[model samples]
Target: MELKKEFTDLEKSAVKLTVTVSQKDVAAAYAETLGTYVKQAQIPGFRKGHVPANILERKFGEGIKADTVSDIIDKALNEIFENDAEKANRPLPYAEPVMEKMPELDVAKDLSFSLTYDVYPKVDVKNFSGITIKEPQVTIGDKEIDEELKAVQERNAVVIDKKDDEKVEKDNIVTINYAELDENGNEIAGTKREDFVFTAGTDGTFYRIDDDVIGMKKGETKTITKTYAKDDKNESLAGTTKKISVTVTAIKIRNLPALDDELAQDVSEKYKTLDDLKKDIVKNMESAKARRIVEIKNNDLLSQLVEKNPFDIPSSMLNAELENRWYSMAQQFQTTPEQLEKMFSSAKQTKADILKEWAGASEKMLKSRIIVDNLIRARNISVTPEDVETRYKEIADRGGMSVDEVKKHYEDAKAKEYLIDDTKEQKLYDELYKEVKTVKGDAMSFADLFKGESN
Candidate 1:
């Protein structure tokens, strides 16, 4: 086949490709298509594979010509794209080539057409060194240690049935049957739960009615009306007013074990004494706080770097990032895209609304990734085979699998490449982290450190 090609650079990291095939190639492809039809031709009046050429053409002339045209175009494009030189000029992986215009198919003349698609943008990362970031100083006080100990005690507490006249109290366990009621006090369908267990005065209890349940005794039934805040975590119930009927089926009290070496032994065999447990808790808390500080610093560094050196992102890549975000959110809800759409419909929200909400964050994430990749290339950061082997060993020990088994899993899932990428990114971040100038800021309490930022 003979062909002529031209490339045109377009805006927003897009390219236009035009190709013209020689008339000789078109005629040859047409003749080849006709020969195949002749050998396989079957007609009513003739034996299979014995139909005359003129009769077959007369019967299926237009269809054969159309198929021939499609075959020729596919072959020509494949040949051009498969060439090493032309392959280098192809579109980005996530963007498909869209036909700009279709040429008229004719065997007597050369074929010409054009396509347009997005390509990877060129980025130059700069000013990544000597960046200043604030690192939070977190201090774990005695109060914090006491709080952690209390949590451990609560986890190990045993539940005992309440007396006949005992009422619900703070920190007591209660099991109840409840249902939501409409304005007219009618039970709403699909809004009822049987044997729901929760601790009084704790966060996340359905309806936040700890005060209302304080005086309710065992086997007592009561109905209460409450209005939830506009920004409630449960979007469906947010800004809504409804009555809920509750029947306390059971009331129980927690018997916390005395805080001592005995309690430490009950909590974990690794703890030899109460002091040992406290030391371990402090070490773990400090390590977690250090990690959080590093995360915040890295985020600040990236944001500053992006601000200093900005570039246009390929629209195709940004759109793909948004799609991945949506898919992940849907997975968390354990539903398909269509079902999620129906859910949003019930909540008076649309897919567009969700996408709009996530657009800014998605774009920022994509931009950060692109910048990091560029920096990795610029700095020549990479992962060695030794790094991969070490990672494999760590995974093997943690998962209780042999190194060879873990290696096989990574290879079978084609995850080794991703592991390499992750290793390279970490290495690059470490290198950048060393150049950062850390400034001492105000101290953050242990509670604030773990509370995290609000959405």
Candidate 2:
């Protein structure tokens, strides 16, 4: 295992490791390899375990040399990495060392070879402390409470089916089969829907066909043309006029519960009065506001943190991330990655093209992840068993599950590890909140505050 090793720096956090094993070790290794092949050989003219070295070499010299060289390289790398004091020079897990070239083996001389691979980047976070971030100032008042209560009332509303001949009217539930039409009046593919139920005159339909559906009777079909504004929120329909064939199949009326003590009692067992329900709603909204503000804070500050700290991510890491995302997207479509690739192929594109398009976003994701990890390490943040127990209880309370159930759910080692890591990350966020200063941003309503986010 006697060898000389040298490292050469490369771009994108890459390193080239050049290794040289001495002539004595090479001779010994080659001899040992050839001896094993000679004993194992069963040449047609020779008995098993009795093949002559000269004959075996004549038949398998190239193969012996290749094996000897590969074995030497593996031994050298294992020796170097296992005993190395500096941890940062270790290759990234996803970065397999690629041999620069197969070395020319010579037993009489030293065996020399080289490998190039990526290592984790060294990061020095700057301007991350004492920074100012803005948080939106939002108030959850009677208007917000009323809006939420209206949704609650609708959820508890009673639905009465109308007669088959009844016409669609405002505030009545309508079920229709709809399809968009091309210029030739043919139904366009991927735009057909059936049994789409929505309340009329409430902007409930995705295509905004509420007004068009009014006055249409059951079993009635009509070709309706609707013009969408240039700045329409629905991107596909914006700035376009499309003809849709709508067939009314069913109609019904919704009778919403009145906002009173009875409705409050029906909504949940804890509330005895409508005012008590409103107070509970305010408390819940306040809790939601605090949680949403944390998200906004992260969007405001962590983005700045990522920008302030710049580091190169190894190409191997980036590629692995991109591949993970590709599979994730394929899973979202409920298709296998191979099938997804075929779909892209039909469009004259390859999986590589899609991966290339996602490289920038993936790189940012990796970079931010590395920065936060570095910060977490530097701060020496950790999660204790008590912290994990508290987190489990919190999850159980939120999910309406028992503490034992939550524990059982996270019983697997990987799940338990994830929970620990999650708790540590939350702790990191807590520390970050304490470290940074928050200023009031623009005042917005609850709806506006959560506009781009999922409810």
Best by TM-score: 1
Residue 21, candidate 1: Cα error in Å is: 4.2
> What is the TM-score of candidate 1?
0.75
lDDT of 2: 0.84
Q: How do the residues 218-335 of candidate 2 rate in per-residue lDDT, one tens digit apiece?
A: 9999999988897987544667788889999999987899989999999888789999888878877887888798888876777778787766888889989999988997786456
Model 2: how far is 132 from its true place, Å?
1.3
lDDT at position 31, candidate 2: 97
Query: Which digits, one per residue and each the tens of the lDDT, describe model 1 over residues 1-455?
Result: 79998888788778888889999988888788878888998778888778888887898888778888788778877887788776547778899889877677688999888889887665687675667888888888899899999988988999899996988898788888887776778876545668878887775355677667888999998998888889987665578776889999898998999999999999889888999989878877776677678777777888888887777777888888878877887686555776666655544567788777778877777778878887887889988899999989977865547999999988854598888898898788888878768797778887887565523
